[model samples]
Target: MSQQSNDEQGGQHRRAILQVAGAAAATGLLGANAASGQTARPGGRDDAPLGARLQGVQHFGVTVQNMDRAFAFYTEVLGGTEVMRDGDFKGAPVHYTLMADQEIVARERRVDPRTIGVPDLKGGAQRLDVRFVQFENVVIELLQYRDAAQPTGSGDSWAEPRDHMSPAYPRSMHICFYVRDDVNFDTFIADLEAECARRGMTQVRANRTVAVHSEQERRAAPRETNTIKIHEGPSNGWSIVYCKGPEGEQLEFVQVLGPVKKTFADAAEARRAATNRG
Candidate 1:
């Protein structure tokens, strides 16, 4: 089968896996069926309602500059599969590749930075060279936009590292991932830390949570606490940390206690669910 076909098949498999996993979690049977790879038939004793159940991550969409290079880097270096190619944004002709494994999910695409609200590149003078890689069920978008008229400079294109949003222009944004269990969570963090160390990269701030409050939730007193920092301790119910990926995109890793619900089977499932809910 072609890569696209493989991706399609894998996506379907992932959907079924999420539904089974969700049903399992709702009935207080978390790891039993997933580890065993055997789920109860439609009318079996193991079946349960699928309301607010924990579903595995479906997939993530990322933006990139060169599809070929991005595909090679993710598949070879990051240990992901070049599953398939599809459109990036709605109605846009740009294409992206979906990559996933048992532990993480990601999508890569070549995008124009201006579309994301970058002002310096107005009038088509700035050409953004970018790609994205998501880990642990979270998306990490990588950017390398170049102004054909200017030289490359240093410093985060978005903003300085902080939890609170300031008046300063937004420099970067990141997608956070919440792990299912502590053992798997720590293992994944250690692996990523080791990989960064081996590459001689300076490990940035490794904390349990970002102190800055989310702008979207500022008005709501008692903000929803969904983040944790790993540097504090391992036994804690929540853990949070950040890493810099290729082209310097801020990658955040989070681990929250209790189970999380996987809303939809695939991207299509998610769309359908949204429509139904609406």
Candidate 2:
């Protein structure tokens, strides 16, 4: 075939790929299950309204400037068990394209940086060092990005000792750990405060326990327990405290005194039966 013919065929192929990507990108995750011949089975975890097919909170990640320092803080101070570490995480093709939008990989591959779900990936991260630390039922991921582009779009790029938004800053996030039911709340706070003080942690504040549940909520619990973890703590409620972790990462601890109030599963079951009978 002639060079012109080859070029024309390549253009057609590329156009086709872009068209399919644009269409399927809207329902990409759900389509993955269908693509594998998995449909909504009765009583299955995913059996729900199309847009509401969510199971639960899987995990959350935060980017840190120093991996080892953050690792020690989470593991030693918080008693989190380090489960896994990925020195180099092989992200999707879209990840590289978004990170370096002006690079050859993005330009040559015809990857649109404005793909629906991916808003904008700031800072061209050189290397991704990740560690998974599990605490009770949840896992927290610690990410250390080497030589990241400045969010301000100034001063080339910075490595360790980089800047971050404080806890009060918009979009700044924090992870709150629940104090064990068996442990004394005051003792937990004392140990944590001492550790943070030793490490020179900033912005440490432990607020007095408050009853967050309103009178309306207390009255509704007999009927509403099925949908959520309604009655979590004692009638007096829980206490919350905040501190700055390594690199000023916002940290939170919550303690609910006494055995947590049970969600009336029997009430929910009776409600379901009534609905069926009706």
lDDT of each: 0.41, 0.53
lDDT of 1 by residue, 1-278 (tens): 47865665456446444544553343344655656789667764345445434344444434433334334445454665432222211101111111122112221334443343332322234433333343444333334344444333322332122334222347546545444554465456555545655655432223232354553342232222333443334344456656544433355666655222222225557766864563
lDDT of 1: 0.41
- The digit string of per-residue lDDT tens for model 2 on 42-113 reads 775456554345423445677666566677778987888876664432233334433554554556767764
Off by over 4 Å in 2: 1-47, 50-52, 90-94, 97-125, 148-166, 197-235, 258-278
Which pairs clash in model 2?
none
Clashes in each model (backbone N, CA, C under 3 Å)? 19, 0
**Highest TM-score model number:** 2
